[model samples]
Target: MLALTGYVDRLSAKPGGTIAFKISSTLGGEYLADLVRIRCGDPNPAGPGLKILPVDLPFGGRFRGRHQPVHLGSYGRIETPAALADVPVLTLSAVIWPTLPDGNAQAILTVGDPSGDAGIGLEIGPDGAALRLVTTGGTQTAAVGAPLTARAWYRIEATVDVAAGTARIVQTPLDPARLGLRAATTTVQVTGKPLLAGAGTMLAATPGGEGVPASRHYDGKLEAPTLVAGDLDTAGVPAGRVLAAWDLGRDIGGVRVVDIGPGGHHGVVVNLPTRGVTGARWTGREMCWRHAPKDYAAIHFHSDDLYDCGWETDFSFTVPDGMPSGLYGARLRSGEHEDIIPFYVRPTPGKTGAPVLFLASTFTYQAYANHRRGNLDEGFRARIKDWGANPNSPDDHSDYAHSTYNRHPDNSGVALSSRLRPMLTMRPGFLTFNDARGSGLRHFPADTHLLDWLEAKGIAYDILTDEDLDDEGVDLLRPYAAVLTGSHPEYHTPGTMDALETYTQEGGRLVYLGGNGFYWRIARNPDLPGVIEVRRAETGIRAWAAETGEYYHQLDGELGGLWRRNGRPPQRLAGVGFSSQGLFEGSHYRRLPAADDPAVAWIFEGVPETIIGDFGLSGGGAAGFELDRADVNLGTPPNTVVLASSEGHGPSFIPVFEDLLSHVNTLNGEPRDRLVRADMIYADLPSGGALFSVGSITFCGSLSHAGYDNPVSRILENVVRRFAAGS
Candidate 1:
């Protein structure tokens, strides 16, 4: 346990007067043991109408244990008998605890007056003050004053003198404003049975006076809480220590500190050693005790491996025990990099619970290898995905994506060979592993419209950055009520699939708003890396190889087709293939009329539900030429519903996800948007009313466009809020 130290306000007051004290503490066994007690009780001497006053921690309640959960939150009291008239009586108490999840647990002290949960009692009346202690379930009273009413700091010490009483109450305090003062020479005598001072009113009152209800109470953040052994008068007061600045130097492990006084209290560490790290590698996620608002300063930076030390860093604060009241020298560094600079000193412990939002994909990101334009290839197609921001981009940064790349013609064009669609370019480095953030969307995920809306509603969020998903022992996505699958979630791993599949099956929600997803099987090898499956022979898009070589390998078996290989055909997510175009304009096939398309889901609430155009709907499959003909490629998962659809891609655009990693080999699945991208996916979760947008690909310009103030934006926003909030 990390015991709190430092000088408190000093006053020459009593029950009805001003008071203060400097306290010391240490660790015993494992719990925080009290070493020195100091305080200035009811300094404002009570003279009249002072009944019961109330005090509580700002946010809700607190825990009840020191170092361990065993016997936690036990409550109780302090005493003062015969409380002279309105000379108020005050007592002290609090709860201690370790961090959540144990393992690298550290002690944290939560201050509060435990309104009598422990075997402690008190009362205040007229005459003098008396203190009561309960042991073996019995009460023992200690008398200390005749009646005190004033304000001032008081130092109480109980020490060695056995013949004389142990408790020594003094009026001296230690304050930085008055640091270099000579230590007091002699201590006063305190005569009371086993414990020290205090005269409780009720204990000495003759009649029922204290019950009259008055208003004298205790207030303020007390610095030190402790317990001493004997008299300090003959031996003199203890000296205070001050030191700061800690340097852990290069890679280290389990570095801990402690105060060298009475109780041997271990100092609470802020920048902890990276967990699970050993022999040069780490197994667990890095953590820090930040005294600031939200931040993401470490990841990917040279300092991603560092930490800082400070309490609510913005505000100046005194150092706790074990260290001097200056900038303590404590830091974690690795060679030339300093991970934690200042470390952290906690705030006065309190935080509000806000709704949380998360943008993630189950199993996403991969390296693209094969290069072949579909029969509908515009230019160097797939090569131009994510707007060439892909790790696979050429050194010159030229983005040769295709026609539908986030709805940008230059991005979406696929270069053809002699019979070229555009100008096919070779990009061997193009990888999908860096698909987190908005990369997986075939585009970017930067959008102010979205961030503003979320912030206004008090939402905390996490983004799977544009790096390959590298989950450790925990499934980071599960904590969220919903997981969004961004546009074109073409890759899936067993872990990602397990987490998402489990999240939904556990009664979570899912939404599929993109097309032609989960349509291929893939593997990641150091060399010759590429997708392993293809569109179904029956419903997949037919690609025409240009002057370059065609796909070297042909996909066979179940996954090789669009039927999902296992369950029913994959188009089931949307219920119809590239055929249903009934909702609007030109079409290869019309919807089965209003009464026939049965997927009436909640997303359709407050809006008309329909499917239209199938061909040329912005390439992938909007309405054919924005006409109502294009189709929906990827279908819905279990418990999923469709709110809208289009047709015209071809006679066979079946809604199916192809790219995935399996237990051995299987099929399917899964969110961000904005920044920049060649592709994007937006969908609403079935639970918690969450909406997912994956990929940036030209979205900022779209949301920023004057037209965004229209229906499309409103509908999309509505869909996300409704589902994510479970409204």
Candidate 2:
């Protein structure tokens, strides 16, 4: 709990812009801060290895307690004063569909503070469905006999009669006949004063006792929770007698939770729950929530749901003018615990910038933001501790939320990903997995190897993100002579695609140093920053498949899946498309006959080796994980030349799912399957610009090896220098 970790207010800022930092810690200790540029994040000594260059700017401050907002559950809240003040009798009713009935106690409707024991609450937990009323007298409880089944809808009602000093709780399956279940009811006499003190806020799915640290989160869906002061007719109650009746379905499309109660006690959702989810009364008539929101009115609340960390600004740092554009972090150290809050600085606005523009795969980083791979073993732990790279991870900080690859508590795919919370995986030296083959750098951290190489080669380059390109379009890249991409530049938006395409078409050279890029079609709402939405429909490589008619994204109404499904297969843009993928193992790229072509012979200027990238930080060699291959059928330019091709990939490597019409033995590395090879492609565009694609995620990881003296580094240097001078 004493781990020192925090996040920044903004991801990228201009040279003159100010960015804030929010720090959190268990002990109140003085922390030292320094700005440092992060180069290579891979800590393996065999690799180019970790490089940190500290800047002179340093600051210190004192902080206390963890500041991370606990948004692990979503619940509706309504405060009623008159209803709980000396009320003789009160009735609470709600429709609930519990997902984890026997897992833990979940509150359906809680009034007053459960921690204080001041009012009444309807809950289902280890003791089964129960109603508790606490007052000045003491506490009285009423409970049913058996626990409810999971994933079943139930109409539960609880009434407290203060005058009669009796409490009654009843529960019945919405479809008892179809479900083959029976209803249960219990009545217990109470001796305590009527705990009808509705002094506390009414909370659905969570205990109302939040004055102190409180929990007992419900993992389920709730709808139409109502409260009445004086119980009259249980069958047909008059609306005039209603104290607070919340229509959880009224604002299904928005963040607001509406209340039809006379008090107008409305509420707002905390950590974004799965809205437009299947309600208790859903009949499968409409699958899309947009079609019939009322049918999908229920909000699926999870115990591990987190949308943002609403932390107050602890301190801020302003980027000085002429500050080099690169990856930097706020180094925080307290006692023995230390952390680095990373952020990117782009070139000053309205500037021509450097000759080389390094395009950070921000979208890809955001997509795999908090991926919990669960592969961190003891050996890996010892390695990171020894390497001083283990700061924080999603495994320890689940309050931040999981990646899109993970599922919600209700068993639905987490389609939305937000960066407002602490992105534990995006930090420097954050490994994706403990790979047995090679260094475990991936996504954001892995991309740093290229930056390390650029610095080692003394190459001046401006850093820009996919977001910047998406917003500014070709204008962002027009000034630069060449645009280079990071490793695993997989996720892309329409604007980003258009910008890169137009940039290259308009004489701006492109160097794609990655594989399986421009593959997924993701959407980030302009109105909602720090969040991206993806639906895996007609998938390429996927953890979970989207439902049939749910192929379109709810945020932008665009087809959400592989870019290949959107008629812009990666081959058209990067000269290669996704083909084969396997474990984190790599093979070498052998020089093809086409590399000797005079048109591209300069790319191999100082490098004489026919075999390229035999040694690398990623998977031990180049061309691993997800591989791409040049294909004319998928829009690889007709003039494009395959300079070199990777070979010796083991049987573990197999073609992507879309490439196969049927399973055959020839699918792996056969001549019939062209997808098994990583083709280093180069083509001259019509606008005097050129495209050079490494066609492998591991290609850039080898650039920093041997102090940038290796063939891989030499080849890349030749490309960048030539493109900047020639283009």
Among these predictions, the greatest lDDT belongs to 2
What TM-score, to 2 decimals, does candidate 2 have? Answer: 0.89
lDDT of 2 by residue, 1-727 (tens): 3266677767888877888887766656466667888887787767766777788764435544454444466665555563454566777877888888777667778777644557677888755677867866676666797688777788787877778978888787888888897778888887867655555454545453444233677787787777777653544264336877777666554567777876787777666665656677678777666676677657767767666667677788888888888888887877777677788899987774579999999888888877877766788787778767755777666767788988876676777787776778888788776766677788988898888888888888989888877877888788888999998889999999999999888888999998899999997667666777788887689978875545656556566899998999999998998888877887889998888888889999888999999887888787777788888888899999999999888888878887776666443334535667788999998888889998888887777667679888888899999888755
Task: Output the worst ten-in-a-row residue range by lDDT, candidate 2.
Answer: 205-214
Q: How do all models score by TM-score? A: 0.30, 0.89
lDDT tens per residue, model 1, 579-674: 111111222222233323343233334434343222211222222211101113344333333233333333432221233234333232221111
Overall local distance difference test of candidate 1 = 0.24
Q: Distance from true position, residue 286, model 1, in Å?
A: 47
